[model samples]
Target: MNSCKVIDEVVNKGLCIGCGLCVSACGNNNLKMALNEHGFLEPQQVSGHCEGCKGACLSVCPFNSKPNNDISTETKLANIFINESKNHNTSIGKYINTYAGFSNEHRVNSSSGGIATYTLIELLARKEIEYVISVKETITTDSHYAYSISSTRDELLAGAKTRYYPVTLAGVFEKIKELDGKFGIVGVPCFIKSVRLAQKADPILETKIRFLVGIICGGVKSTFFTEYLASKAGVDVAEYRKPEFRLKDETSTASDYSFGCLDKDNNQKTIKMRMVGDMWGTGLFKSNACDFCDDVTVELADISLGDAWIEPYRSEGLGTNVIITRSILADDIIKKGIENNALTIDNLPISSLIESQRGGFNHRHNGLGFRIKKRRSEGLAVPPKRFEKDELSFLLKLIHLMRMKVRKKSLEIWKKTKSAEQFDKRMKPYLFLLSTLTKINHYYKWYSEPGAIKASLIRKKSKIFK
Candidate 1:
């Protein structure tokens, strides 16, 4: 139940989500979070003076095994937080309400609807929370991002957009423990889960963390993704000044990915969404641990927010948010915001929320099962997951396998490329193969039925005959 045990069980097994709660749990400053060569945040023990008197680190790690009797207890606690009876979909978890909306003030500058920034501002204005912990660009290093604690409006605004790189809460958690008041936190599902786990072992965290704001996530990428994007934008990673992901463009689709960078000469450069290659599909520079994650929506948060990728809303380039309120506090805040005219929103069916993240749900829930099975077949150790064994079509299995393989190749190619053009040229064939396989898989699944082809033919013939 020491650092050694955590390394053996979680870090080595690739179950560590790199949330960095374990570092904060060790009060003696024995561990520090550092990014490895592959851009993964991992704990590095500074001092070996481990008496193992109290295994606070092990108790807080989400990946650790719990006794069989404790399963029901944990589930019951989760149900209490989730208000299980009100939940409509398992993928999205429990929510008091769902809505599509945007913050009038922050939408243009934010990655999505700006609800997260608005929510933090409201909480601060009401004196309900003293500080918020969120991710922001590191001032000294343009190629890196880090967790920051914001207490003022400008500070909150500075950290508004989505960060698509690796980040951990070890440093911020330390700051929270040092300071005195209630705080809100923003994180993806895995990081939120880590906070919940850490709270069980540390009573102070239970009292300090007054709110949890979660962002729905597909998966976290390695630092390599940032370097790749910088390379594609015609900036050397070391010479880049500041880089922002998801630079909002009013003319682009909500799903379009873009990057903005400043070079040493203070010249601005941008890689438009079209020229950046496929960010999600190719899965370049993705973390190994992300492949095993099952949570698409941040189920454990007080409230969760994500881009509303459905029609009409998706067409709006500023971006819209699909919000799910879980705790009563969050639900009340959202309702009051709408009533006060601080936000624009309309009620949305829970189905739309699920549909907005359909790809993520399928990959995390179903694709995870296939990935786990494949690992087991190869005599590799895999952590337990909730998804049951299901039959995978031949094409579906091949698509998943190839996606993983191509991602590794993409990382290699990215390292070798000296410029954006070279990276794009080298990646064309691999990207094409992945896209074609995905299309074929979907087409076969839908059109392979007997009447599907016949119906298509009849429609075409009717149009021609008319």
Candidate 2:
């Protein structure tokens, strides 16, 4: 197929995740990442630069399903770190060590645990890497953040917090080509996979990008997601500026942080995330590409980091990070930091790390299987996935289907109304149904567990006595 045709299949068919590897990997420079009408970055053809080509671009796409060229993240991990890693699992991929901790200095500034920020700082301090490529505030009328390269300590720290908004690596790839230095990139799983694919296709990228730092992502959101939240916080989308998606709430738990943004007048507006409701679970403005993804912890990254959502860590007002280190060098850096008292951390079982991101895994793995099967049954284009077709209970399947509907419809509804109130009014039924079904599923599982019947009987007996 021609380059245009290949990209059309991916983009038109809703399979493109917009990482921009295809643009960077193109020898003809035929593609560029552009913001779509829905406010998510998508690769658009530069012009009529048409040519019949082998699968150079799609070969690197994490969602590509073409034969031979369609490489799995598992295969990449096996080829690169299989012999070096101390353990391997289908859920989290290969790892040398797992830990949970926070950096005393960086935690306050970071979204969670501060480990990712600290690691990037350490890599720079040790002169192991000359620069760090990460997300930072861009503050345009249309966008609040984008991928940027950081050279100084303060720059990395400025890029510390998590950004759920969609960003593409196309521009940064050109920047990497222009600048000369060793670099470490931080991104979500699919973006990291794209970098790996691009590196395989481009020699310069392979040499320049020395480390991959991954952030555990549930799914990326379109600009509308933030706009919706900003609107709910009483800021107009046109007036929105300098968004802070995760503002720590000292009086509440780690996960109960607030969302803050600057209005047109430069006044800060803040709202507790809980007050905005659980939009994340509802999949509001989530990319269609996310429904097809299966990697939960960036299994292909050198080291993956995420919020520690279990137990004491979750209770801590300052966030905690659950980390999976795949490379020896990455693990050694953590160890050195611990020894120097720059970090306070403890080795955690890999299972605990997996539990911390259980919600992500459930959606990416089980939900992915169901989505793939449904897409195939409808003769729709399904992206290549690491998981096989999974059989979910009828209720679960319906809930999953509802979530897909919610994600798909949210953008259209928001665009039509442009009013958060109208959007919420239209989506109430879907949310109510999804919430009710999810509660049923949760209760059913709770009651079906082993010893649950005995426990329930004891509770009943105690209630009668009381």
Best by lDDT: 2
The RMSD of every model to the true structure, in order and in angstroms, is 4.0, 3.3
For candidate 2, the 10 contiguous residues with the lowest summed lDDT are 457-466
Tens-digit lDDT string for candidate 1 (7-124): 6567877667788888888766677777876677887778666565366665666555441234222233356456533765666766788999998888888999999999999889
Candidate closest to the true structure, highest TM-score: 2
Which TM-score value belongs to model 1?
Answer: 0.90
Against the true structure, what is each candidate's TM-score?
A: 0.90, 0.94
The 0-to-1 C-alpha lDDT of every candidate, in the order given, reads 0.77, 0.82
Give one digit per residue, the lDDT tens place, for model 2 in 295-336: 888877888999999877998988999988888879998999
Residue pairs with clashing backbones, model 2:
none
**Candidate 2 error regions (>4 Å):** 1-3, 67-70, 81-83, 452-466
Candidate 1 local lDDT, residue 393: 82
